[model samples]
Target: MHELAIMESALDLALGQARQGGAGRVRVIRLRIGTLSGVVPEALQFAFEALAPGTLAEGAQLAIEQVPACFWCAACAREFTSADLIAQCPDCRELSGDLRTGRELELTSLEID
Candidate 1:
């Protein structure tokens, strides 16, 4: 799956950071993945397990933070969370195209030593 490539890239970044920080190993890797990011957490974990060997992240803990999708409704002048591609304002019952979040897929932090 594409998660393998994604994990590879994440490990590369983590390694680079660890090197820059003079760390010999990575302890933890934290990621912020939104509901709409389309990346599976299980797949990512499997990918990490497969690719972490012989690397600084060999035994690093992978922490995934799930973010819910949020959208803004102009008619109601408010923001709300949703799990659907087409967000509908709960109160206003209006379809909102103004998405404010839930498309994130990024490495947020790392613990290394």
Candidate 2:
């Protein structure tokens, strides 16, 4: 799965940062995953478990924060959480709006020892 590659890259980045900070090992990796990011959390978790063997992040906890989709409804003149991509304004049923968030897959922080 592509999540394996993604986890590999994330692990590499976290390991690099930990090494630069003179960390002996990583304790946790905090990730922010948006609902619209198209990333499967379970797949990512399995990939991390399989790939972290013998690495600095071995046994490290992967903490994922789920971000909901937020958008601005032009017709309603308000920002609200979207149920899906085609979500219209709940009040006015208008399809036009600006997506504000929920398209991110960011590695926020790493807790290393």
* Candidate number of the best TM-score: 1
Write candidate 2's Cα lDDT for 26-95 as tens digits.
9999998889888899999999999888988999999999999998887668988885886777788888
Model 1, 61-83: lDDT tens digits are 99999999999999888999999
Model 2 CA lDDT for position 54: 94
lDDT of each: 0.93, 0.88
Provide TM-scores for the models: 0.97, 0.93
Worst ten-residue run, lDDT, model 1?
92-101
Pairs that clash in candidate 1: none
